[model samples]
Target: MSEGYQIRNQSAPHFLTFTVVDWVDVFTRKSCRDIVIESLKFCQKNKGMEIYGYVIMSNHIHMIIQSNDGNLSNLIKDFKSFVAKQILEEIESGGESRADWMLKRFEFAAQSNSRNSKYQFWRYGNHPEEVSSEKFLWTKLNYIHMNPVRAGIVNKASDYLYSSAANYVGGEGLIEFELPSNPIIDVLRKERFNFEIDEW
Candidate 1:
């Protein structure tokens, strides 16, 4: 398969989605979820990445992020590597004994590829969709918020605990979210896209 599209603008922010190997539901476990959260925090502190919005789903993660240090790729690469190592360590330490069957399943999937070290936690392609237009940005934001609702996990988007939906809904959340720039919002408005989505 062809590689996913990349938008490498050193000066502009971008939206990115990275999936787990074989679409594994890794985030179903709190340990796995915590690994991702810790990685994000580490990036925020050390990688010069400003995370605008994010949603941690069952097998993938979506984020509106940017790097001011001109190494967005490296930031993401390190973040993924760190999380994979931590999650693998947790698995090896018997932290998720109940997931022994799942661990075996992951091992089986990892065997299908020769590139991984031991077990592959995440896939290689980080299908990045650049948010150059306001309409697209708002659409992606709404999509991220509505993911839980679409998955039938929650009746309301804000009810999902692992996403930035609560941040948008005036509730306390794990990450501090900032509204996108006025120019971006204005462009979205001009395109006649509704930022406030009430239904799927």
Candidate 2:
């Protein structure tokens, strides 16, 4: 990773963007999206990922994440690498209608990079920004929540099915964001969110 995007503070919260090669709309398929969602949940359960917020878009994903084992950088690297492999397999398993075109694009991208032998599903570099302050944290979280809304996928961010906004508004999300203590609560109170937490 380059200096600008490296996860310098391995234990600190970070905002990251993972884009697909050629900006392909592979995630328009539910199967592809589910692969990503499942990978994220796996990372959370086994790879020490603590996801504060996330949004899965058609060609990319945005997230605010940290690691329990203080291996945030490596955790993200593994997550992206694993998801890329699984998604490529899904495309080639004979269900995707855009299989041929997507594979060709991934193949072309892989050929451009000496490290990849077969295909490059995800774009290199997860544009990472360390969340060092309360304002910056909320800024990234708000941006993440509003992504689908801005894309016109949903009228309200909280209504988006594949985002963490639902969790903030007291809805059941696929994964939880752990903020169940005093210090974290104090952090959120510094700049109140639009929604209220009935009981933390």
lDDT score for candidate 2 against the true structure: 0.83
Model 1 whole-model lDDT (C-alpha atoms): 0.75
How accurate locally, in lDDT, is each candidate? Answer: 0.75, 0.83
The window of 10 residues in a row where model 2 has the poorest summed lDDT is 191-200
Candidate 2, 54-170: lDDT as tens digits: 999999999999998998878988998899988888889999998999999999999987999799888888888998887788768778988997898887777888888888766
Tens-digit lDDT track of model 1 for 1-200: 23557766755678788887777787889878877877887788888888777889998999888887987777778888888888878877877764576677667777888986567777767777777876677778777877888898998777887888787666467776566654555454335554343332
Best by TM-score: 2
TM-score of 2: 0.88
TM-score of every model versus the real structure: 0.84, 0.88
